[model samples]
Target: MKKQIFGFKCAFKGIIRTINSESHMRFHIVAGIYVMLFSMFYSFSPTQYAVLVLLITSVMALETVNTCVEDLCGLVADRYEPLVKFAKDAAAGAVLTVALGAAVIACIFFLDFNVINTIFTFFAENLLYLIFLLISAVISAFFVVLGPVGIKEKFIKLKNRHLTKG
Candidate 1:
């Protein structure tokens, strides 16, 4: 039991590290969150939800694997080598393929005109929620572009600057 718990803990730690270090992973995470939020506007069968979950996980897993491959290639090659480049490209390509596949799945599930109209009506009815959604979008944009570590560093710098000013 303890060993299993440790394994889970390590897995979480690896995910956290990857999110901090890999911008692409951050983008996928943000996109996944948006997908989940949009999904809330529609009712899905349990099996459909499960499929969505699987698709999300598959994208994340591929992104993590790609990160690992790129890191390993970096370590193995001090400078540019064609084989290392090929390995890195292949891993990235796998991630892209999975992500695009998920997008296709999303389109199949979400591309109904009635559903799109319903989503628009929902936002139009709930302006406060729309504001919240906008705020979340800005935050998600920052998260994907700057990353958590970059955001923390920026906040720390701002705090220090304010302290010096005061």
Candidate 2:
């Protein structure tokens, strides 16, 4: 029993580590901000919220899987390998699949008058919430872009420094 518990704990820790990694965490944070904004603007019916939640979760989950696949490929192949390329591409394709489906669902939900009317009503009645949503959207966009660009730039600089030293 103790051994089983320990094994479960280890697996849980590994899951947490993967989810908390920079790329996965950045996407999760952005998804969370979008969820909050959506909640502020509209009160989704139970079915609508369920669908929205599932869509968001699917996107984030696929993104995490994509990151894991890329990381595994990098670890296995020090340089480029055809199999690694295929694996990474397939993982990315999964994310794109989920994203496209979610986009369609979002259009269906948002284009309806019921959802739009609720959002407009909320905006008119709750000025503070609307302001908060705007501010959060701006900040979320900045962080989402900044995180990846900063990491990419840092890696490029490091590579250059190593080349100079060599």
Candidate 3:
């Protein structure tokens, strides 16, 4: 039982590590949060929510798997190899395929011509929320570009440097 629990812990750690290391994973996470939050504003049926959740997870899981595959390939082939290149490209292609499918699913499930009008209407009246959303998006973009792990590592290095100087 302890062994199984440890295995589960390791699996979760890998997932977290992937999210911390991968900028695209961070983007997926931010997009997923936005999807769930925005869905609250719309009267989505439970069925729609279920489908959206599945699609979101599918994209995220595939991305994680792709990362794992790329890492594995890199480990086995230290030098540039055509086989490794093909394997990495294939993993990336899998992610692209899933992402494209998810986009189509989202369009079918979540978007409509009226959604634009709804957004404009809401922003026209709720200026504060719009500003908040813009700020949130900018922050999210930073996270996606720098990644959580990168930011933490930089902060730690800065702190250590300051401590040494002090």
Candidate 4:
């Protein structure tokens, strides 16, 4: 049990490392969060939600594998080589392929005009909720683009600037 727990921890650590190093990973995570959130606004069957979950996780897994492959190839090769490039590109292509497929699936699942209008009306009627959602989205954008470490470094720099000013 202890070994299994440790293994899970290690897996989570790898995911965090991937999120920090890979912008695409962060983007996928952020997008997935929002997708799941909006998915709740629509009425989906249990099976539909299960499929969405599977597709989301599949993209995430492929992205993690791509990162691992790219890192391993870079570690193995000191200089540029055709094979190394081939490996990295193939890994990236895999992520892209799945991501595109996921998008298509999502569109098919949730592109109802009535549901979209209802979603729009939901925000329109609840201005406060809309404001909060927009705020969260802006923050999520920063998380996706700058990443956790980058955001922390920015905060540290901001504090230093304030100290210098004082």
Give the candidate number with the greatest TM-score.
Answer: 4
**TM-score on alpha carbons, each prediction:** 0.96, 0.67, 0.87, 0.96
lDDT (Cα) of model 2: 0.75
Return the lDDT, model 3, position 21.
83
lDDT of 1 by residue, 15-115 (tens): 99899999889988888888888998788889878888899989999999888898899888999899999999999999999899999999998898998
Which runs of model 1 end up more than 4 angstroms from their true locations?
Answer: none
The reply for model 4, stretches above 4 Å from the true place, is none
* Best-first order by TM-score: 4, 1, 3, 2
Backbone clash pairs for candidate 3 read none
What local lDDT score does residue 15 receive in model 1, on the 0 to 100 scale? 92
Instruction: Give the alpha-carbon lDDT of every model.
Output: 0.91, 0.75, 0.88, 0.94
Please give, for residues 1-166, the per-residue lDDT of candidate 4 as tens digits.
9999999999999999999998898989988998999998888999999989998999999999999999999899999999999999999999899999999999999899999999999999999999999999899989988999999999999999999999
**So what's the TM-score on candidate 1?**
0.96
Judging by lDDT against the true structure, name the best candidate. Answer: 4
- For model 2, the stretches where C-alpha displacement exceeds 4 angstroms are 1-25, 32-45, 146-166
Q: List the residue pairs that clash in candidate 2.
A: none
Error of 1 at 163 (Å): 1.2
Pick the winner on TM-score between candidates 1 and 2. 1
Point out the worst 10-residue segment of candidate 4 by lDDT. 22-31
What is candidate 4's CA lDDT for residue 4? 100
RMSD of 3: 2.6
